[model samples]
Target: MKKKRSNAWLYFFGALGGVLYGYDTGVISGAILYMKEELGLNAFTEGLVVSSILIGAIFGSGLSGRLTDRFGRRKAIMSAAVLFCIGGLGTALAPSTEYMVAFRIVLGLAVGCSTTIVPLYLSELAPKESRGALSSLNQLMITIGILLSYLINYAFSDAGAWRWMLGLALVPSIGLLIGIFFMPESPRWLLSKGKEEQARAVLSRMRGEKRVEEEAEEIKEAERQEQGGLKELLEPWVRPALIAGLGLAFLQQFIGTNTIIYYAPKTFTNVGFENSAAILGTVGIGTINVLMTLVAIRFIDRIGRKPLLLFGNAGMVISLIVLSLTNIFFGDTIEAAWTTVICLGVFIVVFAVSWGPIVWVMLPELFPLRVRGIGTGVSTLMLHTGNLIVTLSFPILLEKIGISSLFLCYAAIGIAAFLFVFFKVTETKGKSLEEIEQDLKDKHRGSLKTETRTAEQ
Candidate 1:
């Protein structure tokens, strides 16, 4: 008899961790520039400081699967919220280079957990018909967080207030912690724990009383499968999804999106812009990032995942090629500066609409309920690995090869990513998670029978 609650609160607070993820990652792009002088950091240490989070993320994601599975999704998120506060405050107050990198690694742990869990959490809560759009809220929040960080960076750049830029992340961390307590636990998690009555209550509150029985039954049926763990991930039926999820995760980073998110200011300065002008240019890119993600959120459910991936990949390859040409031909001229900004803008627009949102949406959908947490963890682990490699190598590569060669290399990677999506990725629109899992099993079974017939002949 409790009044039905709106799912908006569920989506917002549930995905709020993404804001912290975006802010922490995006703030570093600007903060590192100022802090480099104050902390006496060179390129080697600078890459270490920026990429240290990825190392922590690697471990955090690996651990989060078991943590969320054992403790439940809400508590896992709550734990990450706590880490965000500790890491943000510690990083801001650090005095030495060692202290800063250590604290950033701590922040990375929280980022890793949030990135892996938020999309999974949202996808499990959303109905299959609207799951793509609903889960994309996590990506949308991430873009907002990035834009917020850029704004903070521009505000603080003149004064070189890097500490303030890093510290402001604490504001949203606290908000997420407070809001999570009021939010319902993912009903699927409850069902897995054998609390069917409690699960139904949560479903009723979120989906109204009528839809609870059928959806709860479906989840229950899915759970009846052998409980999944890391071992089950390698089983023939699950391997395809694992390969696709990990592949997308890898390509998503290596295609060079985070280079823009993490090093746009540095990139702009390399072309010709001044410190403040470079930071301002990143703000423009961040704005385009947020706006275009809104476009993805609108069309993702309608257009399906593969098409977005295909279109976005092609656009990225073209933009990066153009960006490389402009930097090579124009060097430090005014024309190069404008062209650099324009190319990056177009790249962000395309990436925001495709890989940016779609990767997160598809990762959770790719796994079955039994292994969803761990599978997503493994996928995100790959994601953070790619991010670490690219983030760490970019500054070094830029110095050694110049921006033109580095970007051109990324464009070639983009072409490879486009081919991977065309050949390997599958459309997941308008399908339930259970349905997707069944389809995987069906295909695996079909392939095995074909091999049997060939052997008999």
Candidate 2:
């Protein structure tokens, strides 16, 4: 009973990084609207400002695996919290575009590292039976962050307070820094680092004394096998998990999720809604995003990963197609405006329930204990890379191709995402992390033998 109460607090603080990730990313959607006037922005500079953090994130996530592996997850997350503080305060106070870009990159580093560490930390700490629901807390907080940003965007829309929107990230970041101090480091990480006594203590605190021994022994055995590095990531046995993690990461962003996240206000304005109306529309979409993510957190364990993903991909594809038709045929009418909002709502709804949570949840589950940190980091790198590409190009693409055509392209990508999930992704709904890793090893061995037999024949 005591452990249960403590864990709820632990998950809340540990996943607070997602709120910062969501807010920093989502605030830009509204902030950029007001920013264009004061900054003397063009498309190129706009993309640069929006994507600089992504650039920083690329490096942050690339290095975080080693950082978390070497220094420990709790410390890595604490460092991210500090970086978030610096970035938030700096970006809000910047006098010019160059300074703002530099600060945003700093924030991006925090975002990158947190995204990798938070889910990894949560998954390791959670029991297998509730891992999906517990891990989904990260996504749930992210949607809440995005929703909060949208509300703030609306509140300050008339005043044009973009700086405040960008700066408010400091509040939760500070909260995370304080809250994390009271939380335990991941037991698996402790065990892997040869801190078995500490690991057992953490597990005892988290899982109760009776369950700690079995779980500790399991982690110890897995840790004894190999220490994962870049080379291990490329080895045959780890490749499938690697592919699945990377694929989901790529498709999650490439399907145009972050474009809406980072540019919904701009997109709505382009569709002929007034500026206030545009930001308000995004608030509605943000609301749906939060609500549906709750639905996902409710059923991710029961419904399984692949089904939710396939359903979401199909829904997103249809929503984008409908959105495209509305933009092309209606062309800025009142009818077109409402239709666009509804389509986006549907898109957000399905996305929050499926791709949004599942990608983060699955990345940690896909790899073995040895490679989990690096695997998650590499996958997050791909996620941010896709995000950077889409976000940096969105305004330019919107200008050249227009919203109707852009959404159609997204719809096409959604199709590819659906097919990829159907073909390449596996179900990890109820299996223990060790069980899944063992399954991968078994499949690899079976494939090697089949190849040998075929070659001899």
> Would you estimate the TM-scores of all the predictions?
0.98, 0.98
Q: On residues 216-286, what C-alpha lDDT tens digit does candidate 2 reach at each position?
A: 88888787776588899889999999999999999999999999988888888887788999999889988
CA lDDT, candidate 1, residue 372: 92
Global lDDT scores for all candidate models: 0.92, 0.92
Model 1: residues >4 Å from true position, as ranges?
1-5
Query: Residue by residue across 1-457, what tens digits does model 1's lDDT show?
Result: 3352467878899999989999999999999999998999999999999999899899899889878877889999999999999999999999999999999999999989999889989998888989999899999999999999999999999999999999999999999989989878889999999999989998887778899999998899999975688889989889999999999999999999999999999998887789999999999988999899999999999999999999999999999999889878777898988988888999999999999999999999999898999999999999999999999999999899999999999999999999999988999999999899889989999999999999999
Q: Which residue segments of model 2 deviate by more than 4 Å?
A: none
RMSD (Cα, Å) for all candidates, in order, is 1.4, 1.0
